[model samples]
Target: MMKLWGRDTSVNVQKVLWVLDELGLPYERIDVGGPFGGLDTPEYARLNPNRKIPVLEDGNFSIWESGAIVRYLAEAYGAGKLWPADVKSRALATQWCNWCQGSVYVDFIVNTFQPLIRVTAAERDSGSLAAAAERVGKAFQILDPALAGHDFIVGDELSFADIEIGALMHRYFTLPIDRPALPDVEAWYGRLKTRPAYQKHIMQDWTTMKIPGA
Candidate 1:
């Protein structure tokens, strides 16, 4: 059996959990990081040098980084399910996955999520939050057209690309911020919401991460 280390509330960790469930793989999850506070230990450092929440141990092999783990699992287990069989399709999936990490993750988590949820309302900078919202909105605008006719990021099927990008949608829609019209993206998100794995992992309560009044 595989072992996963990370708190369930973590979005990054949630991505891994979602994939694991989607693939119908059974694994033990040990809570760590955030309030659990096991990340700084020497034992934990050996698993992940960055001291991140998620670390997957599959027998003697160990992997860190959510995106890498997702890809590894998909290729090793999911085959045609999550990992696209076609070379070009796989490339396109990877492109979107990287795009999510490079563009959406930074803007959403670092700029928007941290400011609004982690920080208290009094100390929060409205201007910076607004700017972050705009940046995130613009990022989604690019995605909107791509999803115009497609149900998922790559195609009609749920792939690694959707797991990477769609994981952030719950927060994006739930957070108190002004969002521009994104019909296609909204429709795509709606489709994702209907999935049991997505609902179980991605659409989790996050009030604990927020300030009292925020």
Candidate 2:
């Protein structure tokens, strides 16, 4: 049986959970981060040296890094679906996945989310937060046009690329901040919300993670 080590609150962990649910792969999920903190233990370090929340253990093989784990599952299990068989389509999907991790996640989740949600109003830097939010909006501006004629990134259907990027949509929309009008991205997000797997994994309430008076 496959075992996933991470708390469900993590967007990265949600990415894996969404993939597993989409692929219809059954696995046991162990809570092990944030409030459940076992990541620093020696036993846990053997699984992931970085002490990150998500670590996929498939029998004797163990893999960390959420992006790498998602790619592994897509390649190993999702052929025509998430992985995409065509060479050009596969390459495009891969590009979007990398873009999500490198560009989107960095600007939206790391820069904006961490400071806005985790830091209290008294301790937070308003200027920095504003800058980060502006950067995130610009990042989405680049993504908005890409969805002009498509329902999903890389293609008309859902793929691993969507899994990676869609995982952050809940947070992006839920954040208590102003955003520019992005009709195409909004439609794309609406489509993602219709998926059962996405609803189950990515559409989680993040009220608890928000710092008081933030």
lDDT of 2 by residue, 1-214 (tens): 8999999999999999999989999999999999898988999999999999799999899999998899999999998788888889889888888877777778787778988888888998888877888887888888899889977887787888888888888889989877888899999999999999999999998887887877
lDDT of 2 at 87: 83
RMSD of each: 0.9, 1.2
For each candidate, what TM-score against the reference?
A: 0.98, 0.96
> In terms of TM-score, how similar is model 1 to the real structure?
0.98
Worst 10 residues of 1 by lDDT: 205-214
Question: What clash pairs does model 2 have?
Answer: none
Question: Model 1, 130-201: lDDT tens per residue?
Answer: 998999999999999999887888888899999999999999999889999999999999999999999999
How accurate locally is residue 196 in candidate 2, as Cα lDDT from 0 to 100?
A: 95
Q: Residue 184 of candidate 1: its Cα lDDT?
A: 96
Local distance difference test scores for all models = 0.92, 0.88
Candidate 2 residue 30 Cα shift, in angstroms, is: 0.6
Model 1 misplaced regions, further than 4 Å: none
